[model samples]
Target: MVKTLSRANYPDLPFYPERMIQFGEGNFMRAFVEWQLQQMNKQGLFKGSTVLIKPRNQGMGPRLDQQDYLYTVLINGIMQQQLVNDREIITSVSRLINPYTQYDDFLRLAENDELEFITSNTTEAGIAYDPDDRLDNGPQKSFPGKLTALLYRRFELGKKGFTIIPCELIDRNGEKLKEIVCCFAHEWNLGESFLKWLDEDNIFCCSLVDRIVPGYPHDKATELEQELGYEDKYMVMAEPFLLWVIEGPEWLKERLPLAKAGLNVRVTQDMTPYRERKVHLLNGPHTAMVPLGLLAGLETVEEVMTDPSFSRFVNLLIENELIPMLDLASEELRSYASAVQERFNNPSIRHELTSIFLNSISKFKTRLLPVMQRYHQEKGQWPELMTLSFAALLLSYRGDRLQRQDSPEVLAIFDEAWSDQGTVAQSILSNSNLWGEDLTQLPGLVESLEANLRQLEVVGSRAALEHRIGVM
Candidate 1:
């Protein structure tokens, strides 16, 4: 008989009281947040478990149920100059509840006095105002709508407050979610008493979460299964590093104990510095390097960073153009940037440029454009790296001549915008929709970017980049 792995196999683990109601059952949340909870429980810092809510119909709810709410998390990355591969059976998720089907059970979860926290990763588009979503609407249309009904039900049963932590990758995500929930409550005419309860009782916490969780490496399952010695249908693979910054009141920290567990988790009043560091250093460089790296004949992040020319190009792009625009300390920024470079150089993770090339237009607007604008405003001159990055981005959409793979959808917009125009570079740079504002209005931005784009079109990506760095 096969020795089936059970809780007895992990006798060192701790069983905790279920206290958190997670709104999304996706891998990012499971591998990141729930994993942290498990870490805390083992250390005796936190004694609360999680009850997962399937906010969407199509997710891993069935798989999660089949696995008895347990999943294996594989963490692989460099630590102390050695490649560390650790696997943990995540049993912190006590149960899974699908509200669409099990509405009564879902509503009853709200009345559980032990439940003190609610968390969600409903994606950026999940939080919205749906006019048709009423309190009586069984299984509401939006995330906030469902949440509003739950909160009202909780309030009615008695004033039960929970700390709301939203992990959506949006600016002030918690605040935006709170605003939408309140709007839904008012529109539904769920009573002024409920609104007062919302104001007085609940806490909406803005949080920043960072972890590259590549869920379920199906291709490597045979090897992974042999290593783990058990079949985990909901296994998730992620990098070693993880950061969760919660912007909430100090009292909540006393309950969470994630810091006590020695994790890189912070409960802070102001998360602005953390946000700035992440956005400018990590996300900014990633966005800027994707097209540049892809066009330079690199397939993966490790390949790009391993190549001397492209690596140096990426470094210069960050140190010169991007760092000068930020207000953070030079040494701190450099340290973070260095770590980012190392993370990209990790041979274990195969983070692809094609995967990162989603919604390029919006990404450029959010990540790269701000730096471009700031550099122009402060220095009175356009940065070459920023200009080159934009040029490479525009050129990326023009379809690769060698590979014949089309650029992403947003890139298609740029292609059409400049199709009927004589001066392709000038036409693209002048488009308000693409650049958010009229780039022609900026003194040297249009000219520099246009010139770079022209050079890239003529000389190609590698040569154009070399020209910018004064090598060619």
Candidate 2:
């Protein structure tokens, strides 16, 4: 019989003062930030624990508490051309507080002298300004509002402010969070002294984090429990690649010496280059590949990466089209692109093309649209493979083959556009709501998309890919 994982069964765990407040109790935090802190603890480079507060009313706090805030992080991927499968028992998190139910306890944490850092991974929408939030609420509805009340609590207690680093996927997350927090302070009529303290004392650092955490290995739980002689309900599985780029002063490195511990964490004055590299190379390709891969009848990223025709087409897309548009060192971009390709090819990670298909139209707007525009501006022609991928995106939204997971409005627009009376390519391209700007404004884009759409229909995705591969 397997026992439940708890500190009672493993009493030799090290303890440290809770010096950080993490605002999310999700799997990504368990596998990424908390795991890094654990590494720092083991190396004796940092002797701090994390207090995780549920960002919303619902979370995994109770289950994590049941396990004594201990869980397993399973890393599986291709690293340095070798397949690596590893696991570690993480113990950096001291405990979790559900702010909705334990609001008093949550505020009490703001008074702790040891608290120095705040990290959050609330989704992109979590950082927005919510007019409905109030200062006196037990727990504010928005993440920013909750933070503002806590900061005000600290201010009232004459306690030092925290160095806040948000891990949300939005660009300049630190700035956006601070913006909302200030908005809350003014809306609540909090005095200028508090605003001064917020600006002068606290550090708001924007950070970019990259790792594909697939959360809870449900399929392998039984076998994994048998191997360990214990059951961990919070066990997280992730790819081996990890990167955390924090844009902050150089002195911040001493506080978080994750790089010194041989991790890929970097602290710099400007993380713009890193952010652009990730968005254009890794995220952009992932978005572009999904519809095309799904249209080719490939279910997972592994299938697309391993297939000859599809793989070559993606490689050409990155090298021939996307890489040339980026404002970074050629060798560095190529190295990162190579690493990204390896990550996509990792067999242990079965990234479903359809899963990546969620919010794909918006994703394309953010990740690929800018580069496409830049390429057109510089070269005076639409990129062939990228245009073909756009065609695939339009076709995938027809809702005939795959389940569409987008806004009702977006789905409806596609449905109407693909109707027999409407021209799918031109209609979508001309709708400014879809791509932010009318994509038809770009010369040759609509024509190229129409041509590619024709080819995709007549020859299918694989054959279309093969044609591009042949030309390249």
Candidate of highest lDDT: 2
How does candidate 1 score on lDDT?
0.81
Give all TM-scores, in the order shown. 0.93, 0.96
lDDT of 2 by residue, 278-374 (tens): 9989999999889888887889988988888888888999999999999889998999899899999998778888888999999999889899899
User: In model 2, which regions exceed 4 Å deviation?
Assistant: 420-423
Off by over 4 Å in 1: 1-13, 400-413, 470-472
Q: Name the TM-score of candidate 1.
A: 0.93
